[model samples]
Target: MPKQLIIRGVPDAIARDGWWLASDATLPQHEPPSPTFPILGEAMKRRMPWIASVVFLVALGDLLFWGYVPGVSLVIFAWAIFAVACASRPPKRRVIAPALLLVLASLPMVEHAQLLSFGFLTAGLLVSVAWLRIAPSRGVEVLGAAALRLSASLPVAGVKGVLNCARAVSHERANGALPAWFSAGYLMRNWAFPIGGSLVLTVLLVNANPVFERAIVQAFQIDIDLFSLMRRVLLWVGLGLLVWPFLIVQAPKAAMVVTPPKTGIKLGLNAGSVLRALVMFNLFLAVQSAMDVSILFGGASLPDGMSHASYAHRGAYPLLITAMLAGAFALAARPFLAEHRALKPLVLLWLAQNVLLTGSAAMRLELYIDVYGLTYLRIYALIWMGLVALGLIMVAWQVLRECSARWLLIRSAIWGAGALYVCAFINFAGLIAADILTRATDPTVETQTDWHYLCSLGPAASKSIAQGTWPKLQIATPFWATNCLNPQPVAMNWREWDFRTGRINGYLAVDAKMRAVRDEDPVGR
Candidate 1:
């Protein structure tokens, strides 16, 4: 009374595992599946064409940038290539936001190739790539994590990409079928003799006929500049390295990881120590604040034998550093503020004073600039002071809300980046030039304009200088400025052309025409 089952076309293992088969019946045998290492998946195979195109397009960096200053070409190279690469493998979420930011950041590069513009562009690229790799619901912390991952992978991305591409080609060849005529073995056997014979016959003909020799010489002549060739090769490699990371977006495994709180002995950064530090800092800052209000802001005279300019110049930078240290202290003391309620007030007071101090430092810089003249450094100092003030405000907000340090840092970075982005688009050089020229012409102003510094601001300030009529003011234009005013016609292709340079060139042309007309007519002059 045993169970009997009949199976047809089944493996022996299945029949042995409980199924019964008839003795006369036959079954087919199948081999076990082997392990596989897919060098190129179906998706990757589809993207191969785009990947190849990006590689070829980036390789042309030598042609686009060589012997020319970067301008719109940088914008084109950075944005267009990145766009195409991103399109090849579209992100799952948050595409429009990053795309808009990338475009906005690159727009500055189209105007000019200043360090600020380049910096913003680089930051924009990193952030956009990071955004593309993370989830839609992710926060700035996740974005930062993804960005760090991308940056960490950059050093090896190019090599990894090349290996991947090579493996894909091999994979395709191993799996695909080729026509007999196009197969590697077939081509080698059939074409080698013909190609070799043609080369030998061409050489013989060149030796036998003068006309053939001249034609051969003309056709085969290659002026191989080894240096140029090496440079282009290096450029291609560098661009490949820079571009591959963006092309292959590697999403982070996790947005953030929460670690358990450490159960160790508490450090000295407790309530007592924080309270004492805050009290001491507040007292010290209070003293400085009083001095600033009395002497710096009230327009009162300084100590005997000390000039206002000297006082302002000496105090501006040091006070800024002091504010920065104060900000650091505020951030450190944040943890203790909750336990010791009294420390919060003290910290807030300290931060408020630090903001005041930043303002005073900015006022001091203004005073010094009024006596002397405005320069790039002073403008930068002003911008730094503003950022420090904003940071202090953010620290105060963090304390009030009892937010995490990560929250504070993320917000601070966002505000700072915004400030920098706006600063990138500002024409500071033009402002500095106009300020100096205006002060120089004022009969009551005693400031002496540094024409040398003006020249160093480059073509951006040239229009202001020209309009200031330095010749009539009895101040001769710097030789560099003269050259800028009458720049020789140098051949520049479209890649090197930028809005700033074009505007300057146009202004110079019109100014030249006006000058010529004025010289010809006495009334116009």
Candidate 2:
């Protein structure tokens, strides 16, 4: 007779005549084995064809386009997902938005490719998974949830699953694996004869004719660096891991919305004290506002030996920081002052004044740009001021309407992302070149144009440099000859052919023709 022992939360062992009997079944079981146990191997076996196809597509893209334009990699990644979606059972229609967005994101590769490509790619991937797996009605909330899960799920399950799948394939190969239509041996068998025959014939022809051999060798000279190939392969594998989880793992069905419980406690500060503080703060801001109006707008004489440009330069960045601080104070103070009736109106007035202060900061930057000439930094500063103004407005709306904090943060983040994405596609360097050239030519503008700075603006400014007549500007003969006259040929494949670079090349050709005509003439050319 077997002893029926109830050992809760302990190992299944029993004493019998001073000896313990043990078997594999004697081990304590925390939970029953899942029917779908060994999910990684099973899933990989089922999806191996699609997975291999995706990896091949990524590798092909790396070979063809990755060196030329980084953004092209994102497009290839999106296409991989699209291909996988097409293969999925009962295919997901919802992935279209994110896939299309990712494709649209690739257009910047030809114009203004930059570091933001990776971030844009990440967001697109998250959205792809969220849209297909989560409810559509969740809207932007899905982005936040997807972002949260991304960090936890991506590195943990993805790398492990891939390694396990590799192990499974190895194990299967060792144990007489079942042959599939898409198996490696099948593909090799089908392609071997044609590929081998073509190679043999090509080699024979190459040996027969020197011209043919040279032409063939030169035409197909794949300048592939072994180290670069390895680096790109590793990067593709990492990207593959990122994408694999999205296809297999389920996204959060609903966002975890945490509503803070009402504390029933008002702000810690007394109404009178807070009101008094605001009154003093407003008075201080009023004095600064008055000074700005008089000095910046009214064009009053400087108090000492300070030039107008000097005053403008000194105030530009500092005043921007001051305005930012004022804005931050208002945002931080709004919740505390919600119960105070008189303070809310005062807060609104304070915010409005801060907006005016931001405008003054912008004017200061513009003044500095006029004196020192336009630069990438000045352009970005102006744009930043505009965003700050927008942010202040959003803060006011949030406070007054009692909007959800999460909602406000998500919206603001989205706005910032959209702005960055848009900025990435814009040819700001061209605009700067145009502005600088225009300023240089204007009779009223006496400031000497920074030709050195213009040259430093990269290929986008090449056309402007080419268009300028050097003799009138009294630019250095050596500098003019080296920079504007002689343009170096930019070697690029089709993928790296940017709009600005293409235009620059056209200008260079025209400039070369002009130089030739001048050389042909005897009129002091």
Q: Highest lDDT: which candidate?
A: 1
- How many pairs of residues in model 1 come into backbone collision? 0
How high is each candidate's TM-score? Answer: 0.81, 0.71
lDDT of 1 by residue, 12-85 (tens): 67766744356666554677874343444564666677577667767567668877887778877777665664
Clashing pairs in 1: none
- Positional deviation of 37 in candidate 2, in angstroms? 17
lDDT of 2 at 26: 55
Candidate 1: regions farther than 4 A off: 1-47, 59-63, 90-95, 129-142, 164-194, 256-267, 297-300, 470-473, 476-491
Stretches of candidate 2 off by over 4 Å are 1-44, 65-74, 89-92, 135-143, 151-158, 166-239, 256-273, 437-452, 469-481, 484-489, 514-525
